[model samples]
Target: MKTEAEIKVAIETYGDMIRRICFLHLKQYADVEDIFQNVFFKYATKREAFDSAEHEKAWLIRVTINACHDFLGSWFKKKAVLTEDFSQFQIDPHSDQGHLLDIVMTLSPKYRDIIYLYYYEGYKIVEIAALLKKNENTIHTRLRRAKQELKEKLGGDYFD
Candidate 1:
C-alpha cells in the first residue's frame, strides 16, 4: 500500500479530474463522492508502481471509469431510487457552460465520454482512443458523430 503522504499527493493531483469523471459517468453527486473515495482507496492499496506521472493519471482514469461502470451495473444501483440533488453538482443552468454541460449530459455515455475526454480534458484523438481502449478510427467516428449531434441540438456553430 502507498504511504499516507503518497496517497495525499495523488488525491491532491487528481481529485478534481476523478470527481469530474465520476459525475460524468454516474450523474449523481452521491455516487460521484463514493467513486471518488473508492478510486483513491484503490490507488493507495495498489502494489505496482506506475512508469510515470502520465501512467499514474491514466491508471486512475481507467479505474474511475471501471468503478463507475461497476457501480452502475450493480443490482443495488438498479433497484435504488434515491432522490438526486443536482444542487451539489453545481452547474449553473443559466450560464453557457452549464447549458453545454446539460446538453452533454443528455448524450449517450459513449459519446459523452468521447466528447469529455477529447474536448474538456484536452486529450488528442489518439490519446483518447488509448484511454478509452477503443480503436483510433472508432474514436474519430464517435467524435465526429458527437460533434454533429451537439451541433444539431445547439443549433449553432458551437463546436467551431
Candidate 2:
C-alpha cells in the first residue's frame, strides 16, 4: 500500500483528471464520484512501483477508464434510470466551449475517449495508443475520424 502522504499527493495531482475521465464516460455526477473514489482506492492499494510521474499518471488514467467502463457495464447501471447532470460542469451550455463539449459528449464512447485524450489532455497519438493499449495507427485513424466528425458538427472553420 502507498503511504498516506503519497496517496494524498496522488489524489491532489490527478483528482481533476480522473473526475474528468469519469464524467466523460459516465455523464452523471453520482457515478463520476463513485468511480473517482474507486480509482483512488485502487491507487492506494497498488503494490507496483511506477517508473516515473508520467507512468503513474498513465496508470491512473487506465484504471479510471477501466473502472468507468466496469461501472457502466454493471447490471445496476443497465437497470437504473441514468440522467445526465451537466450542472457539475462549469461551462455554460450556450458558450462555444460548452457547445463543443456537448457535441463531443454526443459521440460514441470510443470517439469521445480519443477526442478527450488527444485534444483535451494534450496527449500525442503515440501516447494515447500506449495509454489505451491500442495500435498507434488505430489511434491515428480514430483521431482523424473524431476530428472529422467534430469538424462536420462544428463546421470546417472550427477545425481550421
Candidate 3:
C-alpha cells in the first residue's frame, strides 16, 4: 500500500489524464464524468499494490477504458439513439475540432474508439492495445479501417 501522501500525489498527477481518457471515450460531458469517477472508484476498491508510477497510470487507464466499454454496452441497451452517426453535430471547434471529429463520429463505433485513442489521445498502437484490451494486430487493422472510413466521409482532403 502507498502512503496517503503518495496516493494523493498519484491522484493529483493522473487525474487529468484519466478525465481526458474518459472524455475521448464517451464524448458526452456527463458520461465522461461518470467514467472519470468510476476510474477512481476502481482504484479505491482494487486494493492492489502498484510497483511503480507507470504501473499505477496504466492500471488507471485500463480501468477507465473498461468503464467506458461497460457504459457503451449498457447505454445501447437502455436508450434510444441520442444522435445520428454524423450531421446532428453543431461543428463546435473544440469538440469536433472542425471536421475531424465529425468524420470520426461517422465511423462504426469500434473503429471510432480506436481512432480516438490513437489520434486524439496520442496513444501508440501497442499502448492503445493495452488500454483497450485489444490485440495489437486488431488495433492496427482498426486504425487502417478507421482512416479509410474517415477518408470516405471527409473526401480526399482528409489526408491533405
The pairs that clash in candidate 3 are none
Q: Arrange candidates by TM-score, highest first: which order?
A: 1, 2, 3
lDDT by residue for model 3 (1-160), tens: 4456765776799888777666555767667777877777667666668888677777887787778878878946368565535434335755547567556666776786687677765779998888777899999998987888788786675754
Candidate 2 lDDT, 2-82, residue by residue in tens: 999999999999999999888888877788889998999899899989999999999999999899889889999999985
lDDT: which candidate is best? 1
* Whole-model Cα lDDT of every candidate shown, in order: 0.90, 0.88, 0.72
Give the better candidate number (1 or 2) by lDDT.
1
Candidate 2 deviant stretches above 4 angstroms? 82-90
- For each candidate in turn, give its C-alpha RMSD to the true structure in angstroms: 1.2, 1.8, 4.7
In Å, residue 107's CA in model 1 sits off its true spot by: 0.8
Off by over 4 Å in 3: 1-8, 75-91, 94-98, 157-160
Please report, as a residue range, the 10-residue window in candidate 3 with the lowest summed lDDT: 82-91
